[model samples]
Target chain A: MFNYIIVGSGFAGSVIAERIANVLNKKVLVIEKRSHIGGNCYDYRNKDGIIIHKYGPHLFHTNYKEVFDYLSNFTDWRIYYHKVLAFIDGKKVPIPFNFNSMDILFPEILSKKLQEKLLKKYPYGAKVPILKLKKENDKDLKFLADFVYEKIFKNYTIKQWGKRPEEIDSEVTARVPVCIGRDDRYFDDKYQALPEEGYTKIFERMLSHPNIKLMLNTDFKEIMKVDLKGKKIYFLGQEFKGKVIFTGMIDELFAYKFGMLPYRSLDLHLEVIEKEYFQEVAVVNYPNDYDFTRITEFKHIHPIKTNRTVILKEYPKDYDPERDIPYYPFFDKAAREVYAKYQELAERFDHLILVGRLAEYRYYDMDDVIKRSLEVFEERIR
Target chain B: MFNYIIVGSGFAGSVIAERIANVLNKKVLVIEKRSHIGGNCYDYRNKDGIIIHKYGPHLFHTNYKEVFDYLSNFTDWRIYYHKVLAFIDGKKVPIPFNFNSMDILFPEILSKKLQEKLLKKYPYGAKVPILKLKKENDKDLKFLADFVYEKIFKNYTIKQWGKRPEEIDSEVTARVPVCIGRDDRYFDDKYQALPEEGYTKIFERMLSHPNIKLMLNTDFKEIMKVDLKGKKIYFLGQEFKGKVIFTGMIDELFAYKFGMLPYRSLDLHLEVIEKEYFQEVAVVNYPNDYDFTRITEFKHIHPIKTNRTVILKEYPKDYDPERDIPYYPFFDKAAREVYAKYQELAERFDHLILVGRLAEYRYYDMDDVIKRSLEVFEERIR
Candidate 1:
């Protein structure tokens, strides 16, 4: 009998399963609906020996030392900063809209003026969100904010979320910021790198414990039943007393008791080009011109010895449960209210815990998800 | 008595000393003429609580995995890519002159034409030397090469080496390459970073072995003698049979017997400015503007919470044995001939081994020096 049942085999589920089996020395079963583990972070080698991310580019960056150290045990790292550029005014400029980007986009006089002002207002390395910049009363700052918004943020946000910048959560917009200095990296986290062997290896190593059993291509509904009225759960048609770590969609877990949550999906179009390189960096955003938000070249992230290069163009669209995969869980007021009811219902269960992006309906980064999982393991599971 | 006597506690000497003590379990004496260790790579926190590299900015970057793994024992590393920009034509552009620099310097149409020409000729990310680029038969490429050479390379080369590009060895000018891509890092080595604490700490930890003794403020000339005719080395006025790892200036060790191996020195002028940041990057080359070759802000390398910033301006000059530190050893045919003579003289001794930038008269990076030292230990000392 398993001491714990973890639904979903992403960082959240895999981490907890690994911890439960290794740290507690207890039997744990991990159920993954996907054919393989690593969930959305899965990457595999192509015919040309290029490691391509199946979903989109997942850059691992964080300021959390504990998170970095914890992940280090499973895999070695390749020092990669995850550079990104946004095509603006018929030229590609570094995104997160830095001083370098400003120099490329604006004239010398205006670039210098804007840079000086930004430095004066914020610290050298301060990352100012566009929304924060929009609140600026200063005329030049307002102009600068408007320029960045129109050139680099608006159309992309509209395409990705199917909503204006103001309609979506501010947290989502804050992901891409205006760096006061010239650092062109996507994130200025203290620890920024990629797993030497694609992220799947980290998952494989993490779940390699003798006490952990993985059920791939298996849905939780196949062997598990939750009796909400009786406040009891049954596993394999028997009464189960062990904890249930649910990392799947909260709405679907309770069979949409309240309502369905909203999410943004992506149509990932991949192309293998017969060239040395398609672009200078790993990712490039087309804010205004293209229907797709961004294009990612895998070779830039995982440098391989091949003349052929593979590129992924992401077309963000409204997610349908019947058709597409939920990539981003952006919340509205109604969705938040519904989530609150789900949380209240989840608390009613004695041994059930809700976690991960889908469960919480939060836009958590890779490190944030791991951090939460670690916290849950320490506070509840341990 | 120590089994090995090493002069200069830099990466070259310290690495060998540590290996001898730990790997071979042999007693090693490391003598550094300076009051401190780490040679030119020494760094410490100043009054403002900012780590400052005493001689100059020494950013450690290498493609050698073995060298990186070897050094990992002594210290952890922070992710740092040394970004250098040159002030050209009233604007700061990324150095090693790339597509980005070309865009900044040339008009839009000209920049496009030049970039297309470069791409057609070279693969993406290929680093081309200015000399090679200058010999281009293509009219557009030649024009572009001429412009880059005149604007960026020529003046900096003249200031740093005190010789025209045509006059100096082609090897010296090849160090600063023209990257075809938009990577703004001064060096694009696979591993680029700085020690987490400081370089001095690494040196301290490296020499912490009980078998390794460090002698500071002690010149080997004060106690050690080399008998050319006798082919003997003596330490503390006693005939010593231990291996002597000499990493000091080659000509000085032999009392300028082959005249003097030419070197370039720097006049480092440090200033503490009452501002948050003095520049956008850690280092900025002022090729055509000021007398000083470059300015480096220490805060960028080691970010700290101080309103006042510290910067170092380096003024290049001819090396004087009486004064100034020998920073760069750029050799002419005569200097190379002189170095060959010194190398032959040092090779005559039974146990004397010369390694490092100064001793070998080679422009070795930090990793190269460590690698050579490790090689020397394996081949000779071990």
Candidate 2:
């Protein structure tokens, strides 16, 4: 009865659902195992009337104007430039190891020398990843790179990925950069802001189209039977004539033909406190000292005026398929080889489409997820 | 028979018990209503092996060398200089409204002007209370004072004390100050550190004296009866021979004859996160925005190389006499008057000694509480 059946209601599926209903005038059914929409992006007003992200803090930021503009259609924006601090050597310094951070961490003479070297080497306001910076010929630059790598990146990488920085892909370390200038904002994006009325509200607006039928707390595996050889998808024992869009784990979709793909899951410790605020910044990274990765104070991101605030401490753990939801896909060489075989198998059915972070087996920011969903809709569904 | 009977086994009672047993060489019985001995200062390793304060984050910092030296006898120290950041207008600035904060908050011209004015007005490194700074005649200084009072002090006071700054005692406002210099450290105490193990460890060592008898999960009121007219105290309906030291709420002791004294209670939300760390600092203050006052990442205070971290969000609520433990006394005029009456009632018995924050109806930092207990032993019990 549906033109397209989408599994999962996160940014990937929801964005596709909205486009199918609105752009193509097609009936779309979105099946989500979670009780709420927005997948990991799910946020709700807690008992104390503070809007909190059930997972962790997700800041909406993008260099892509199309992605930003598309999302703007769903919700108004509250311009929030996110800033992060790393706790190093008993001091809270601006992260990305910017020039200001250089001044804070080192003595006056060393700081000035470092600042001069950094500005001369890198363009003003440019972000240089630690690994790239480490290759610099100068001793001071090498020392600065090593210092950041040890103090801010080394332990955090081990805790986050359960591997050393050198073991992981260079792309992973490249994501966290050391800035040359004094800009403290975490992301250097053209568009950076949170949804005016939380992320959930935006999802509500996007999925409000009459053609989009949403059934949450329903897993696709419960009803849909995939016949890869026959190239037929059956729902509730009947052959499903519509196109199938699977946004969940690719390994689970194929029943682990190439064995399970690895992922890093997170245990979020959330608390509602009595005070109006908690921390100064939206997020603070503890790379060298603690067991957890970071602490996020929700009020700092949302900027709601209330008597109480909400905070989440994020602990990274090895993803157990039995217990935890798949968060970050492990993109190691072994994970890639396993994913490649799954990708080849998924190609057997023309009607079956794989999209989003989980299906693609890649990490994505909010904007990239939206952009990916838009591409899937335009290329396959249309 | 015990030589001394101590009620409420927190810092006050524990310090006195240690002194009586170790210094005075006499048997001391300590009665605690809570199952733990540290009272509000209690901390323990949670299920995740992260040391968390059962009550809240209690950073030990004091200018009194004697207080530091005395506590050093019990536990080793991990020097932790406490730093706090105030979330104001989407930026995490150093608290105490220092020169660095001025630079971050205002424009370049305004920041320089304010910096010059602040240095000229107040001595370098001196913390000027907002009320005292507001007394400055210059417009720029007046604006700075008003700005800090409005941005940082006002809402936090209202949430903390349920009062406006002027409504509360000047002493309360005076406690939080604005520094003229760039020093971001919260306190300029002579000694600032956490117990190398944990606060609970220190309490364990302090109360380990052979002559000290600890009876946890037992309230003094349950076993002891005070006869003001007879000038006698009875334990389990029998006459008690030694001096009685009460550290509980003074109003509760007198059965609230002059009406109950006001106090604030905290609801702590604790979670074990997967990350190695959470916030950049041990504590972050949300002055303007949320209902909860602050979030504390415990590992930053007590650093141990582990894979996960623990954090606490503290919510402030009105003290429910039936449900909540009194954390902070509401030192308004009417509450002071009520406490004075309780003091008068207690003065009748020469053998009964009142000590600790609750008994005195005052807030004392950890070191001050220890100093007060030492003074009580030398001046009265000795």
- TM-score of predicted chain A against the true chain A, for each candidate: 0.97, 0.98
CAPRI rating of model 1: incorrect
**Error in Å for residue B118 of model 1:** 1.9
- Cα deviation at A38, candidate 1, in Å, is 55
- Which 10-residue window in model 2 chain A sums to the lowest lDDT? A43-52
Q: After superposition, how far is residue B24 of candidate 2 from its true place, in Å?
A: 69
Candidate 2's displacement at residue B204, Å, is 45
Please provide, for model 1 over A207-323, each residue's C-alpha lDDT reduced to its tens digit, 9 standing for 90 to 100. Answer: 877677665545677658888788788875677799999999988888788888888899999999989899989999999987999999999998875678999999999899998
Model 1 clashing-pair count: 0
What's every prediction's RMSD, in angstroms? 24.1, 23.0
Q: Name the lDDT value of residue A91 in candidate 1.
A: 96
Distance from true location, Cα of A123 in model 1, Å: 57
What lDDT tens digits, residue by residue, belong to model 1 across residues B199-306?
988887887776776655457786588776798987755688888999999998887887988889999999999998999999999887889999999989987666
lDDT of 2 by residue, B38-85 (tens): 888998664344577889988899988999999999888888899888
